[model samples]
Target chain A: MRIVVPAGGTGGARFVRGLLAALAEAGEPADVTVVGNTGDDITLWGLRVCPDLDTVTYTLAGAIDEAKGWGRPDETFTVRDELAGYGVLPTWFGLGDRDLATHLTRTSLLASGATLSEATATIAARWGLPGLGVTLLPMSDSPVETHVLVQHPDDPAGAPPRLVHFQEYWVGLRAAPRALDVVAVGAEQARPAPGVLEAVAAADVVLLPPSNPVVSIGTVLAVPGVRAALEASAAPVVGVAPLVGGAVVRGMADRLLPALGVEVDAGAVALHYGASLLDGWLVDTSDVHAVAPVEQAGIACRAVPLLMTDVPATARIAAEALRLAEAVRA
Target chain B: MRIVVPAGGTGGARFVRGLLAALAEAGEPADVTVVGNTGDDITLWGLRVCPDLDTVTYTLAGAIDEAKGWGRPDETFTVRDELAGYGVLPTWFGLGDRDLATHLTRTSLLASGATLSEATATIAARWGLPGLGVTLLPMSDSPVETHVLVQHPDDPAGAPPRLVHFQEYWVGLRAAPRALDVVAVGAEQARPAPGVLEAVAAADVVLLPPSNPVVSIGTVLAVPGVRAALEASAAPVVGVAPLVGGAVVRGMADRLLPALGVEVDAGAVALHYGASLLDGWLVDTSDVHAVAPVEQAGIACRAVPLLMTDVPATARIAAEALRLAEAVRA
Candidate 1:
């Protein structure tokens, strides 16, 4: 079976790892194509750093810093220190030395006229992802940066919002600022990267892991043809809530969700994606009471232990999502 | 007094450090502008690497690895290892993590339309070199890489030469292959960087450090107006021999000098520069017998203890070169 997953970064990456494990445990061979969100990509120090893509890639390749759920294992911040030494701005986004090679190769390849998808494939092959039955793809080839509008600190009346790169809000400020708005800068003009549509259309199941719906998967769907592809695909679409009991499992999804005026609840998230696009939704056992609201919205719902504590625990969650997908199909 | 010195990496950097010390010991504060050779500069993995300029910067800043005579002290090779992991070419050139930042900043600044001179000043200020009465300048603002023509390994007759980057010849091949010719690619069209001509023309004295005369000083003089500026200036030009007893102190100067068909003797190197460009030349004490030959070439010559065993010894050599400049001026 071909499984298509539109993912953000850390959370999505963990969920995909679970899905891979579940498939392996079943003794079934499967093809997994992860469409990584590129909205968080930024050009830093002349290097095109795709944070989401690298996070997913590093996690899948077993090179991820397990503690952080992102960046390379045993990563050193020497390069970051050096960049700061030169007074390069936005030093808040710590890029590890090992991780920098990926950006260097990607930037060099991109500068040489390779599209983001092409560069992704080149980097993926190096990680032996193909051998692991995994293909990592960028959501779009065109540049799409997630910029956040935060309430101006000086403006007590909040007349004008200060705009900053999504990274500055998320990583730099730790999402402390009250974000007034979130915008995927170029998503309106972005077309699905090569193979993105085909992967979705050909998949037996399309999964949205516990990624940020507002900025992560939301940015991917914002790309012109992506949402249409999911809607048109005959395959059932399943989503696992990033929020558990009104709080995010990882990252600052809580801060981002309310910016769009969406209630930070499992059922509210499923409804935000809406019944038409999502055939099924998975909520944590703690929010099992909220399953009825999601089911009432015409989407099949499942209550499972959604915390990806380990591969097996995550696999159970993945299995639950797949079971819900089967129920939706029935 | 204004002093200008044209330099390369390693030997040149050491010489410059000694010159700084010599000036300090004499309690004479002088405006010292170093015209760093850019011919050896290479773009690796899409980052503009000014090796000679960085060596001089790092050495003078007290951040250089004394043991290696280049790169930053306590540097990590994580980036280099990672690049090798990605199978990036020319992995032979070891770029330390701390050093990579310099290249990144320079590349970013250059990409943003800052002239190399402007970028150099920015980087120099970060190292506090400007505060220490020194200014680092690139020989030319334009890109000029040294490409070496070597005999193809398979061709015993040496009919067709294989052209590779000077770095590949020096670092990758370890100067094992006979370099048929060394070409400063793009030097002919290159113009001296901003302030280079002014520094040389306005100087009370100009010095050529004990760098590779064939490639280092040669490439700098190859710049369209640099040689003319030095020739037109009333200031005396003094050069210290890179070769000691027909062999170089370090690096592949011995291999490179012979590639140009010039004898690897102190006097021969002085004759190559000629009386028009060089007012004085300093050879090692061991090569005192060759002083008459250099003097006959219409350049004042002196023999001194040229080996830079330590900072003090190197400073003494610098002092000797200054004394020769004074004598030539008289």
Candidate 2:
């Protein structure tokens, strides 16, 4: 089946990385299309750093840092130290030596007038992922920076006033401050990345992995015509809850949930995705009580253990989600 | 006393590194100015690779490898290995991880419209140099590549002569093949690097280290006005012989000398530099007999035990060369 996955952060990437492997093991070849979120993209030290896009590329290449779950594995930070020596002010995001090479190569290509999509394709080819039979793509050629509105501890007004870049919030601050809003700053300006709509429409199944709703899948949906394409497609669109219960399985989703005014629970997450576009929603047994509410809202909800302890478990969960999706379509 | 040193390449750099320490110990502060050869300049994989200029910078920065005597000490090659995996071919020259950062910074600066000389100054400011208040300038803003004409051994019918870049000949082939010529391809068009001629003309004494007389020092003289500046300078220009007895100290200088139709001996080398520009010449005790021939050519000749075994010894050598220049001028 043609699967269109709109992934944003590491969580989304980890799931797809397994899904591709699972499909291969099952003797079923999948025509997989990825619409990566560009919202977290920023011009870092002059190189365009698309964290989400790199996550996908690294994961597919088997070069992703399995422990930290971002950047290339076995990387060095000589360039970061050198840049610091040059009196470059920001030293928050540590760019490693090998990683700096990719950023440099990408920046050089972009400087030469190639679109981001084309550059991504060239980079993907370098990773030797062609044999995987998956088409990876960024959501837009235009820049889209994700900015979070957080309540500053120093602010006497108690207002969530400042907008911080995603990397600053996640990597620098470690999401310590209480955030009130997460905005895709250039969402209105960003068009769907090339072939995003076509890939979505052609897909037989659209899977929304356990990525952050606000920043991961949210950023992909924010692009013009992408969400519309998913809604218009005949494929069974299934979403697996990022929030396993009343808490995030990984990452600092709990801290961000309050900022977006979304409840820190799987049921709320399914409801947040809404029933209009979602044909099936997978929830853990802890959130089974919320299934009726989701089904009543037109999404067929299934209660199952959703913690992906291992690759096999994650693939099984995907299969169960697909079955639920088929039931909803029937 | 001011010294004009036209240098670059590992040998030149390593010598200067030792000379800097030696000069400090001898309580002599040289108003040193380095006219770095830019013949090895290349834009590899879109990166401005100034092998010679970087050698001088790193040497002055005290970060050069004493063992390899080329790149940064304790250098890592993660980028080069990663590039290799990505099918980036012709990875002959080993660019260390820390070293690549320097190249990238330089390339980025150049791409942003800064002249090579301006970029060099900014890099120098990052690393504070002591006992060396030297102005480092490239031989030209326009690239001047050195090409090696070698007889192709693999060709069946004595096919047309094949020419390869200097790096390919020196680093890749290790200069084993029979070379027809060593041409400074673009030196004719290359302007004297900014402030080179002024440094040469204004110096009180100029001393050449035991650097590659053909490639390293030859590329500098190839620049448009550098030779003329040396000819007109009131300063006594003296050169230390790279050839100890009949053999080259390091690298394939003996092989290269033949390409220029010069014998690989101290007397032949001094004869090559000739009388008009050279007022002083330093030869080893082994070649003490050739001092008369050099003096007969209208240049002051000195016989010195010229092995740079240690810092003190190297300093003694520098002091001897300068003393000879002062004596000749008097």
For each candidate in turn, the interface RMSD (Å) is 1.3, 2.9
- For candidate 2, the per-residue lDDT at B226 reads 84
lDDT of each: 0.89, 0.81
Interface RMSD of 1: 1.3
**A83-115, model 2: which lDDT tens digit per residue?**
677663356888777776677677767877889
Which digits, one per residue and each the tens of the lDDT, describe model 1 over residues B145-207? 899999856567947787888887888788888888999899988989989998987899999
DockQ of each: 0.76, 0.30
The top-ranked prediction according to TM-score is 1
lDDT for A275 in candidate 2 is: 75
DockQ of 2: 0.30
In model 1, how well does chain A match by TM-score? 0.97
lDDT by residue (A1-330, candidate 1, tens digit) is 889999999999988889999999988786999999999999887789998888888888899999988898888898888788888544788888989889988888888899999999999889888988999999999999999999755558847777889988888778888888899999888899999999998999999999999999999999998999899999999999998887987889889888899988988999999988999998988999889989998998888888888989999988888888888888
Please report the TM-score between candidate 1 and the true structure: 0.97
Q: Show the lowest summed lDDT stretch of 10 residues, model 1 chain B.
A: B151-160
What's the CA error at residue A237 for candidate 1, in Å? 1.4
